[model samples]
Target: MPGPAPRVVFLGLDGATEAVLRPAFERGWMPNLEALWDRSATGTLWSSEPMVTPVAWTSFLTGCNPPTHGIHEFHAIDPAARTIIPNHAGRIRVPTLWDAISESGREVVSLGLPMTYPPPDVRGIVVAGSDAPGLQWAFAQCPEFGEEIFRDLPGYSHKVLWKRRPRTLDELRSVSLRNREVFRAQAGAAERADARCDWSAMMVHFHNLDGIQHRLWPYLDLDETAAHQPEWTAEVVACLRELDEAVGRLLELASRRDAAVIALSDHGFGPCRALVDVNGLLCRAGLQRRLPYGTRLSYRLSRIRDRFDRWKRRRSPEGTSRRGPRSIEGEVGCDWSRTAAFAPFGQLCGSIFLNEDLVSGSSAAGRTIGEIIDALRAAEDPDTGLPLFADAFDVAERYNLDPAAEGLPDVLAPSTDGYQAMAKWAPFSRSLLRPDPNLPATHRYDGVIAIDAPGVSPDTRLDAELPDVAPTALALLGQAVPEFMEGRILDEAFDRDEASIGTAATGGPGIRPARRPIG
Candidate 1:
């Protein structure tokens, strides 16, 4: 008989890539991950269409596409108010992996997973990641238990590691020190969770690596001067070494539970050479128009909720603001009647929202959308003669959605390699392209996923996307995959399956089985 069900441990390395990991492993900076890599089935985990953290990680949690889960980007647009708002834990339209596990008479200890602000009520421990306003609001259960960890863990935070970009070696050191502190805190929290509850499954996410790669890409890459700087190199190595130590501790815990360990990332990392001004291109192409009565009371009225939210966040116990994004669209008014389309917001990829009424009930299959796609595809940097968008495709078609579906963008434009979308729209904004003055790197779709467990083939290759992680984890844990999930179990990774894994689940709260005639 099967000895209960195999436990699972998920370790999320946010924005991790082979370019960095292979090198870090070769240097022996991350011995723990290297050891796991040696025995696991490794492959590229394709990210969401946008390849952004919020969208990709949300997909990982739900095992559903953006349309099914209802989160396409980090910030969602309140269609009624036409106001942009932060996408939070409450926005998920389906049951998450944690919920699925708890519903199956099991418990989960999910720590610091992205898009988990205002943590949901679950059977075991759950804490918010970068989305929470503060730790005060991050706990899902046992407030007293979580508060103890928060108080004891030093330099723990749910926001950016560095307040400013590290421009010098000294600044990099400061960022590294703070990052190591955060790593220790999260690792400590994982340790404490075991003493509190015997969880069936556990997931620990480390997000600082993404920020580090983004702000310190030059130093990580072979930039000659930046790579050769001993002080800066030392700081990077020290910071990642601390992260490796923390991950090693968790891997030890997995061994104690005899759990199958799965390591993954939301997306990979790469250097950013330029920023594509999304809105600037739209305005220049005569797709969007500005309001005649520019920035005034009307603009402030639309953003009053954001103001109130900020005020409320400030008054929270931690006093740290998890502020929603404030972009030029909120400050500058738009002439909706005359505008055919507008860019709400974006980072790695651009999102374009067409005027709903103008486009009628047809979603991505609209004449205006086609014209805009043509215009976007034709755009090129006059200075460098390089195309702005690497690919411009319909989100609905890409995600295989109903043409009449709502709450999704009409088109998505992804920048070419080494380019990121900057949806800047302001009265004074100029040019279709500009030098990115902030982070030097951005995300790619080549995130990683590796599973190390008994009976799994060594050195096996996995071909999967973000949503596949959750379903595969469920299958490994002896649970039926929710029927709504589009991903399937990676049967190739396991050699001892007797055809019971990857079965579809029946009706549940977040899922309603479709009607079918019995034979």
Candidate 2:
């Protein structure tokens, strides 16, 4: 019979865009990636609706839409508790690609993939990434493996602190250098583990490119004023060059194993100029309530004090100190008792949730939702006079959402391609839209995907949605594409004879609804 099916190596580059990669490859900074692109089927990969990390990566992993996967954003709001919880791997309702592969008795190795914290019970090793509770305990399958791997490669961290701004070039250098080390270490661990383990599929995700893009986009595409800062620009280029080196190393490992290699990004990236506080708009419309004067005053003072502390630290020789992300929801002064509807902070997609209890006895829920939708659609950027929200969806009606789905937002407000919905609730003194200080670069919908394998055509254009990655990977391994997966195999990438082979496994019992109680 045929020798063991060719192994698959998937490299996930978070927030990579053709806009950036094309130019980088053309400049020869990424020679290995350019070589792969020349020989592979490549094209833009469509992302999830919101195009955020958790949602888009989950879709890529599950081969299903957000409605089917049940992960909408980074944080899910509990209507009853009036609190938001971090979204993690446990939030995924459907079986993942690794789960299916492992079920077929294939050993899998997954490293540094987002939303994989509290890692699933897979047949092989899993070291969680961004959403893990703590860096020390990010691994699930073998807890001690994390420490062992880090011992072999010191200075390994799953995440870099980005909430605070770097005050000096040295601070920025430190951040970028640490990030590079972590990424290289993670890839090194994956290479060593794959060599030692009995594995059919291995995936390694690198977030450094995305982090650098977010923090240094302005420097990367410098204006005359920013061009004066040569150090910043040079540092950004160095980080990118290091990223190319890491990609080259991974490709080398894949080739050594004779494995098919696929490289993809969850979403693209672009500069973000303004912030649109959706909750502030709702409060202005009387859809949400503001806190009492005294409470509001106290909150404002606390914010001032915090800013002062940050300022003091920046002035010190230590430069900027790393701080955990402060909750935007806590800054919102909404009075839930009188609130009919509110959008929580911290997502590009502005999701509005209705207080079901407050509206329980009223028949005006539909009318209220309609009014909110109209208001959001009418919202315009005062600076450019363009509409803030491109489209609004009643999630239940649009996505065929089950009424019982937990933490389901009643409305989803999607911004235009270049814009992002701001979740802060504080009132704007001048214009409703203002510059986003923390994040200069944000996500875009069209990410990049390139596939290279034995029968795949060279430089052929492949039209693929984000969900198709799972089925395509499974098909490449000669495994059946699960019937439950909404995505189809990307047959166009393969030769006519190779494409004709059967590769659909009957889906096991259809998707099971999440058991978590719906508010």
Candidate 3:
């Protein structure tokens, strides 16, 4: 029989930050996580630029940057059409550990982790996260388990999605319980899957902590009374405590001495006091012309307002209220056809990539594109007179830009720390620039990384560079790092006494890029 297969469990807590977590522990909200931190090697995990979920998590999975993975931001613009494509649409170009483990004949269970949409053909079960509605139902259609998993979820998703939409202190407590219930079901399934399979890695991503921070952060600071209410503090603490209990439940499932367990977050959370309107700034600098003067502010206001209306509409019947027709304003300088390179980072910021046909060879289009980037880089902030972006990276210098990707955008514009870019054709608003001086909690760069087992560093500090996490996981799994993965494998995380696992080159077994159909 093969030597005992190491069981690895990754608990991904979305938007979990050490700032809130550390304090919450002091107050006894997260005793389980605090205990895990003390027993395991723990430190702040750094995330890549734009610090959004999809970008950071994708890098965490593939161990490659957006350029190499072809997922630059939440939204990617087609260089030729300049139209927005869903950030969640593309497949990862590189191999992921899920693929690697499956190739080694190990089974894995992934629950509620994003970007697993159009699920990969792995050796185990993969249920795409709840972000995609009816995901369990969708996965049920997969030939793998047939209806086994789906048969159990309809009764669960109600408590999973709605019961946890906390609105009050009492509701917060109830949400916690609901989250625990969902986790219990998911964890039990994972354990059963592990027992039946040879080797397994189960990942569960929890979002309760993130929801609290987003709604309550503005009100936590007593200094800022506008957004704060007296009832929010206790609710935040309760949310943390709830997460701690969920952690305990997960730990119970894999308490094996040889099993390796990890709890990690893609990035941490904080208050959003400052909001930079990049599109507005660019227009003021004359780099981008604003919508024609007649353009109404409603066009901009509608973006924010429509979300609430849509949510209500979804909850209410289709035509209950006097719903007015949605309006569309015109673009000033944007050429929908010729404009290549778009920013798709959750509307928080933008990044650009070029199209294939336009940027290849001696096309004048490619030359025009380079000039556009140069112009963008030179553009300055009208108010502060500072550069529009932090820095622009060449595709070759900063990313694994496709060699044959000639028409892809040649430049990638990553925003400054707090400043994010957007490209809506509307007049700029300074009101959007004002920072929330009253925010109690604020966003920080600190993330969570916890590991337990033999051969790993007991306690150590880790570099925040996005490249480090993947190589670190590869090193732990006894896999050789590919030269294409620019990040260095973290050798320091292991102890010399622990025998290094075999380095057999098990090429990843999963989907490869589909060939374009020939006419």
Candidate 4:
């Protein structure tokens, strides 16, 4: 009989961009990853539309487009109830890579992967990702491992670690230090768990890359030479050094298991200058209605009650772990009765729901999706005479989305470069557009993908996108690629004389829609 099937290890580096990676590699901050890149088949891995965490990572997990996966934003909006529930693992509609791998009678492991909260009961261990409410009891599908993971891994915590970005070198140092420890903790968790489990496939996600960049992009931007403060730059260097060591450790594990190693990112990252409030644009266009003072005050009171309820629950013995569907509605202060359209979710990329047409519309306010799209596309800045949006399209038409899919958007209108789009205005913002105080970093379309295995070519280019990861990973493991997968097997990446072997190449790699000329 043939030897055991080949193993595969998928490493997810969230929000990694070449802008940072090339510099880090050159600076010797991430020497391990640099060494791996020297012999790997690498190229840009473009992210899903919107290029946000929940959408892109979910695509990587499901091997499907955002519409197919039914995860377009960080929250799922209920049109009828007017509530916004946090998006979690339960929101994924299709079979994940883990689902396919486990179904093929192989063990797998998923660590620190976002959008994986409310862990799936698969054939192997699944330590929930950053999206989990808290790590206490909801950290893993196997409850036994949760406490051990928390105890063994030092400084382990989920996303949302800070209220604002660091303003000074000292503040940046504080954030960067914690980030390095968390990186070490996650790497430690994966290492410790691998010692106990028998697995053919594993995916470990390092979230610190994105968090640090989002909070400290300017100091790290390869461009802008004068902005690189020596002291502040050292903090970023320390964090990346930990990442390099973590990469080396995981690579060693892969070598021992004789596994094909693949490292990829959910999305790219860059500095953001302005904030584009999509709802403010809608309100100015007379499509959405802000609530009256009385109603607005009532919503504020409800918010206070919600916070109190959360505080009270934390004090109780039940703890923060709750295994159930998300119940809180979105806090979008809109008058549903008169609202024709509203952008209740999406960050960096705004998702618009045209009242009943997208599930949350009021019949009294009649509007066609086309009319709204035209209005958004027509929005311009008064001072600069520039368009607010890069592009606004009816999502159903663009992605060929399923008409029956719930929690999907009617339209996707992202801000142009130098601006981060939001569904609603900040509480005290006076205008639709304003400079970002936090200097927030936002996602870009070009991420990265690199594959290393015996048969694969060394340093060969392999340009692909988010959806390609799943089927390719399945193929690499000597498992059958499912028929539903839209991405190709990357047959070109492998050596000849074995073309279309166990894993057949379906078609060409997926390409995002071409970009239009910017203003």
Best by TM-score: 4
- Each candidate structure's TM-score, on Cα atoms with residue i matched to residue i, is 0.87, 0.87, 0.73, 0.88
* Per-candidate clashes, comma-separated: 0, 0, 13, 5
Clashing pairs in 4: 83-329, 84-329, 84-330, 355-361, 356-361
Encode model 1's per-residue lDDT on 1-519: one tens digit a residue. Answer: 122237888999999988899989988899999999988888899887678878888899998877778787777566665566678778888989888899988888888888777777778888888777666667745687777876787566666685556777677777788899998887888889987878988988998889888877766644432556667778888888999999899999999989999999988878777788787777778888766545456656766856776777778776755555554346435776667888777776778888776556564437778877888899787777888777887766666764234456678787776778867545556666766656677888789988887667766788778888887788778777777877667756655443334432222222223221111
* Candidate 2 lDDT: 0.74
Ranking by lDDT: 1, 2, 4, 3
Residues 1-519 of candidate 2: C-alpha lDDT, one tens digit per residue: 121237888888888888788877876667877888888889989888778888899999998988889998887766455456567888899999999999999889888888787788888888887776556657656766776786788866677445445668999888778776776786788877786678888888887778777767777653321435668877777777777777788889888889889899998888776777788778778888777656566547656655676677667764542222333345565666788887765567778877675766435777777878988988887777888776777777777764325777788887766567877645534345767666777787889999887777775787678888887788778777776777766666766555332332223321222222122
- Report the lDDT of model 4 for residue 225: 29
Candidate 1 Cα deviation (angstroms), residue 401: 5.7
**lDDT of the candidates, in the order given:** 0.75, 0.74, 0.55, 0.73
What does the lDDT read for residue 244 in candidate 2?
A: 75
Global Cα lDDT for candidate 1: 0.75
Encode model 3's per-residue lDDT on 327-420: one tens digit a residue: 2212223322333433223334444444333344546545644655675677554576766455665555445445224333355565554444
Lowest summed lDDT over 10 consecutive residues: which window, candidate 4? 510-519
Tell me, by lDDT, which candidate is best. 1
For every candidate, C-alpha RMSD to the true structure in Å: 4.9, 6.0, 7.8, 4.3
